[model samples]
Target chain A: MELKKPAMAGTTESSDVMITLRPNPEGGIVIDLKSDVKALFGDAIEKTILEVLKEFQVENALVNVVDKGALDFVIRARMQCAVCRAAEIQFDWGKEDAHGK
Target chain B: MANELMRTSLYAGGTSPVKMIQAGFYNEDCLVYDLEDSVSAGEKDAARFLVYNAVKYQRPAGKYILIRVNGIYSQELDEDLEAAVRAQPDAIRIPKVEYAEEVKRIDEKVTAIEQKAGLPVGGVKFWCNIESYLGVLSAQQIATASPRVVAMALGAEDFTASMSAQRTKPGWEIFYARNAILMACRAAGISAQDAVFSDINDPEGLKKDLEMTRALGFDGKTCVHPRQIDAVNGCFTPSPKEIRNAQRVLEALEEAARNHTGVCVLDGGMVDKPMELRARTTLAKAAAAGIKVGGVK
Candidate 1:
């Protein structure tokens, strides 16, 4: 269960944002997201998405999201599962490792 | 079975001191305030008095009271039942019901008590705690015992101890037990409640378990803390999308029935009886949440 810890995902809120995150062998990560998601979701979806990613300990990753009338519940469920898959949910991406560790 | 909204119940009587803090705090769902644990063996009499008084007239809206008396065969349990029948709670919760005969045995007592009280002979339902080795093995028989039986459950801690399972949280290894109880309950036309997560402080863990329980079609869950009420409410409440999905399914099904078709397709799939049962549950959640899910039958 050894996952290389070199990945990153940046957050964006414009409509048409694509969220994608994965491992890059070169030691960093790529984050790609379209900008239109914010327009589609407004405040609730944005808050849920951010909370889901960080709660599942997704750090050092790339993300791309395409919003098509998705709500906060949908975003949260999807992002939580995706982050679980990406990070194995094995680390504390929320705070400094030692304090959380 | 009711063909309309039935009140799904959440259980809250613990073997230790536990209580729900307010009215329908778990979305004002059904509450079974425990007399067994809240009162000491010395104070069991007083505890039953308090619970009976609560049940008699003061139960809040959206809350129904059931007394989790001591296990059905205990001497203390016999005393608790006598007091409970005098006050007349909704259902008698018999812990660790391992056999069909246990239902018959408890039924005899309930019948005698109901007869003596002359309380309109409601038959006061009998259900099982399918929580031990024998309980799981004989779930189907126990569930089918009598028409008065309404549900089945696996007391996770006791069942886990019987299985020698090693998990930090309560439900980690008991998903099979849960499903077994659920299947047998459905087969016998009854509801199933998932066991309590004993750690009251772990709201996240509680919420996660209750969410999974709801996803798996459990009508309700047992709880040991009032703080867990909000978590259970959040986990079990239907989102707008779920209600909309239920609405769509109901409409499609009604159309198909008009055409004399047994199945209807919704969201690129066929909506059949099983899916209808699930949709009905979603509808119940919407109803419980005070959101109108139209076309519910």
Candidate 2:
């Protein structure tokens, strides 16, 4: 789905990542990540964001992440919220099932 | 999670990943991942997704997990139900429940979601929050509305507001509602959970309130902080003296049975059916609390 607008989810709390998604018609999923654990888990965080984007079928977007040592599930949840808010779509359980599949 | 010890159902904010990750490590018997009052209106969607994923991927074991959804009439109810049912927590707690019809409605919706998601029908249980005068009056009907209703909690803050009564530490204002809810739960054969004490700083006050709660026959209490879990659990657990007395009563009954006699006596007093039942319940509670009670099964 194409992003309709810019939206953000999560916070700068101790174990959360604030994810911001903007519509990027030609950027092809550009990520700007600022995290204290960049040297250790940067690739894993970016990969989680990309996986959520793929699950939501968003091929082009600018993903801005402010990480505070969040886990993989937290990242996935935040990314899903951001994508759903940006795409102006209600969260569908069927889509979640498809993602699980 | 039905029939499990739910001495303290602690709330973890649905949007806070820190609390959600650490909630299970606490000694609380139940973890209530709250998506209603703790979450703001704008963050409702985020909280739903957060709680869903938390329960789906990182569910904590050995604790009763409950996802407290929004009110039955709210716009967020549908999405909350959809995500909550799919996540498959032990139960979904419906806040601000006022009528039996509301419970039935939510039960039907949950059944549909379970079917669509290929989950077992009636697998999802419910905990209703009776927080109003109307709800208290209809507590019996609400408790008996659906077979999946395993427990009902009294939301004192809302209930007092509904009654226009002053909230006090002594909790005289909620006395009637407490008994009403307790009786209803007893009549319906479901667990009755008491309201939160709200004052986390005063451990003495909490202890007093828990005394009243246990005396009123409440099975458990809602806790806002993890520090209160041990106190609540201890208050609900059967004491060593009670356990010993229960064992003696059971032993007397067993001896009578072996002697082919119907008379059972303990401590110079005849033990009746009610005493036997209370003793059994005491032993059961002791066992559930992980206390070693000898000479009793």
Question: Which residue ranges in model 1 land beyond 4 Å of their true spot?
Answer: A1-101, B1-27, B253-273, B295-297
lDDT of 2 by residue, B1-297 (tens): 343788889999998999999998999888999999999999999999899999988888888999999988899999999999998899999999999999999999999988888889998899999999999999999999999999999999999999999999999999999999999999999999999999999999999999899888898999988899999999989988888889888999999889988788787899999999989988888888888777655
The residue-by-residue lDDT of candidate 1 on B1-297, one tens digit each, is: 111222344554322211333433554355675765454664454345345545543454545556677775666776566657655665677788888998877777777767766655655665467768779888989998877688777788889888898655646588888888989988988977777778887777776777678778786676665666666666667888878887788888888888997657787887878778878878877786777666547
By lDDT, who's the top model here? 2
Query: CA shift at B90, candidate 1, in angstroms?
Result: 0.9
Best by DockQ: 2
Can you give the lDDT of residue B21 in candidate 2?
A: 94
TM-score of 2: 0.96
Clash count in backbone of candidate 1: 32
The TM-scores, one per candidate, come to: 0.64, 0.96
List pairs with backbone clashes in candidate 2: none
* Native contacts conserved, per model: 0.00, 0.79
lDDT of 2 at B168: 99
lDDT of 2 at B97: 90
